[model samples]
Target: MSAAIWLGRFLFALVWGALLANLVWPFPGKGFALFLILLFVLLAIHLLQLLMFASAYRHFVQWRRGDYWQIVVFGIVGWFAILNAQPQREQELKR
Candidate 1:
């Protein structure tokens, strides 16, 4: 198991835990409509995340390795690992 997979699990667990906590403990003075609005906002944000991940996958394919499914399942963490693994190129000196 790679660090990327572990990190991915941790992030997924963290997000889901937060969501669970919010449901269990409602905000003071906030109504159902606010919750619904927040749900939509969160969904939109998740969609954006997916799009950004997909774009990164396409752009970094040359440098990337391992299972692509890991990228899909692990989300940000997997992508972070792939990006991190890329070697830094030295700049050529101008003559």
Candidate 2:
């Protein structure tokens, strides 16, 4: 689970780095709409992932965290994002 969370975060970091690169690159001035769109969508997914993880983090009793309700909300939203982003897979062992 931590791997999934970290992978998601890493993707977001890559996205940020790419945007910075794009900004630094002296271009012919043509806009890169496709890359921008992909980056935005990925960023959204990563955001949901972060929310889900943060929600889980709030459960640590030692942390004395607040707002358990918000965590549930974030988990729900993250699930939605994952469902939308994931490609359909064949059920190898449907019960």
> Which candidate should be chosen as best, given lDDT against the real structure?
1
lDDT of each: 0.57, 0.47
The superposed Cα distance between candidate 1 and the true structure at residue 47, in angstroms, equals: 1.7
- Candidate 2 TM-score over all chains jointly: 0.38
Candidate 2 lDDT for residue 33: 60
Off by over 4 Å in 2: 1-15, 24-31, 61-95
Clashing pairs in 1: none
For model 2, where is the 10-residue window of minimal lDDT?
A: 61-70
Q: Point out where model 1 deviates above 4 Å.
A: 1-5, 18-39, 56-59, 62-75, 81-95
Per-residue lDDT over 14-87 for candidate 2, one digit per residue giving the tens place of the 0 to 100 score: 75677656657633445566556655665576566557665665443222132233223234343433333333
The number of clashing residue pairs in each candidate reads 0, 0
53 Cα displacement, candidate 2 (Å): 1.2
lDDT of 1 by residue, 1-95 (tens): 36656767687667555655667886557654576565566556656666677676665544334535445445566566555544431112222
lDDT of 1 at 7: 68
Residue 32 in candidate 2, Cα distance off native in Å: 0.7
